[model samples]
Target: MPPIHLLDLSFQETAEAIAAFVVETDEGPVLVETGPHSTWPHLEGALHKLGYRPEDVRQVLLTHIHLDHAGAAWAFAKKGAVIHVHPVGAPHLAHPDKLLHSARRIYQDQMDTLWGQMEPIAESQLHTPADGEEIEIGGVVFRALYTPGHATHHIAWQVGADVFTGDVGGVRIPGGVVMPPCPPPDIHIEHWLESIARIKQAGAERLWLTHFGPVDEPVPHLDALAARLLDWANWMRPWFESGTPPEEVTPRFQQYVQEQLRSEGITDPQVLQRYELANPAWMSVWGLMRYWKKKLARG
Candidate 1:
């Protein structure tokens, strides 16, 4: 296993809310998850602490192209880094207007402060690796496992005996429960469960989550994530059917999730806030609602 240095981005001035991993490859340092551009200065400082500069990272492997995970990738690409991503996400990175527009709709005024700026990466710099394809950088090899439940273009990059599970592995901060981040436009529950099975089959020694950090126990962590994913989806079913406004469902869902956290013994206010930052309740409310609407329409 190559040396993996986990860099905390301290998203929203909150510790452990986001992370970017720098792996030592023979050729040079390869970065996984650039995090949002809002945290770019912090990420640079984290890299510098480890004696690396952004230019030293020639390869950027993204688990997915969401703003939080891959938003800052273009900055690395500007320094001549090759961006590795899923096929479906390649175009979006190369042409970010639509992606940016969608995100703007969700976060109007808070966009700049939350995610900073995102520019288009040249198509030449974007490499869309096939599922199970391995790319060797320096001497370390990274195998991309297609895991698309959190987002349609998500991939869990497996290096050595461990996996860098973007959002597919769920968000689990220290002393918090594992919660799947079900953001909209592609929150298919069935596909997500299958992806969980795929992660189990990968036989990783540990699951490296971009949301916070590593999980030593893959099976139990994943099982809990699967259960919670179903639990949250089912919890939102009746509300979706009742045509309840998301505003009404959001607070209830937030309370429900917080109570679960409180039960799990995470009483610290900051810890609870980190959970919300990593996986916002309102986003999940809409995401699950959309999932139910689509699933029922198919019946």
Candidate 2:
């Protein structure tokens, strides 16, 4: 097995908040996630520290096409690296206008500052792998498992006994508390729960989250995340039925998350803010609310 090195992106000057993994394989080095384009410099510095250059990366595997995970993939694609992603996400990367437009509506003026420039990757360089597909790069075999819930295009990469779970497995800071990152536009609770079961059945020993580092206790971590997801979704179901404005729900959800963090011995305002940024309470509110609304419509 190749050694996986964690590269700290140092997001917002906070440690362990966002990370990219470097896998040293027999053929060469492969980068798992690129963090975000805004943090490309930090990624470059990390690569430099590991004695690698931008061009040194010949293959880049993405768990999803979310900005935080695959925003900088174009940078590597420009360096002649083949960008492998889910079929659902390949078109968006090839033509990023719609993707950027949607994100701009959410990020507004903070777009450039928060995500940096997102360039379009040539379709020729994009490889859309099917679910259950196995891709071997640099003598490393990665199995792409379609894990939808957080995002329809999301894929969890399984390498030997380890899995690179983008956002499908949820977020956890250094502390051992698991929190669901239920961002909107695509948050299917049923699908997500199924995805969690899929990951557990994979028998991975560890889960490498893009938000932070490796989680050694896979089963327990995933179980906690599943429970947290249902708890949050159930909490929002009533709020959705009541037709409470999103504005009010956002703050209430924030308080709820803050309380959870406090109980876990994380009370600092700054730390709480970092966790919020990683997985915003407002986004979860919107996501859960949307999920319920859609279910209700179907029923």
Against the true structure, candidate 1 reaches a TM-score of 0.99
| lDDT, candidate 2, 14-125, per-residue tens | 7778889999987788999998899999999999999999999999999888888999999999999999999999999999999999999999999998898988999999
Tell me the spans in candidate 1 whose CA falls farther than 4 Å from its real position.
none
Per-candidate TM-scores read: 0.99, 0.98
TM-score of 2: 0.98
lDDT of 1 by residue, 1-299 (tens): 79999999999999999999999987878999999999999999999999998999999999988899999999999999999999999999999999999999999999999999999999999999999999998889999999878898889999977899999999998878799998797999999999999999989889899888999999999999999999999999999999999999999999999888888888999888898999999999999999999999999
Evaluated at residue 155, the lDDT of candidate 1 is 94
Model 2 spans > 4 angstroms off: 268-270
Cα shift from native, residue 161, model 1 (Å) = 1.2
Question: Which 10 consecutive positions of candidate 2 have the poorest summed lDDT?
Answer: 268-277
Question: What's the distance in Å from true for residue 58, model 2?
Answer: 0.7
Q: Best by TM-score, which number?
A: 1
Alpha-carbon shift of residue 164 in model 1 (angstroms)? 0.4
- Judge candidate 1 at residue 37 and give its lDDT: 99
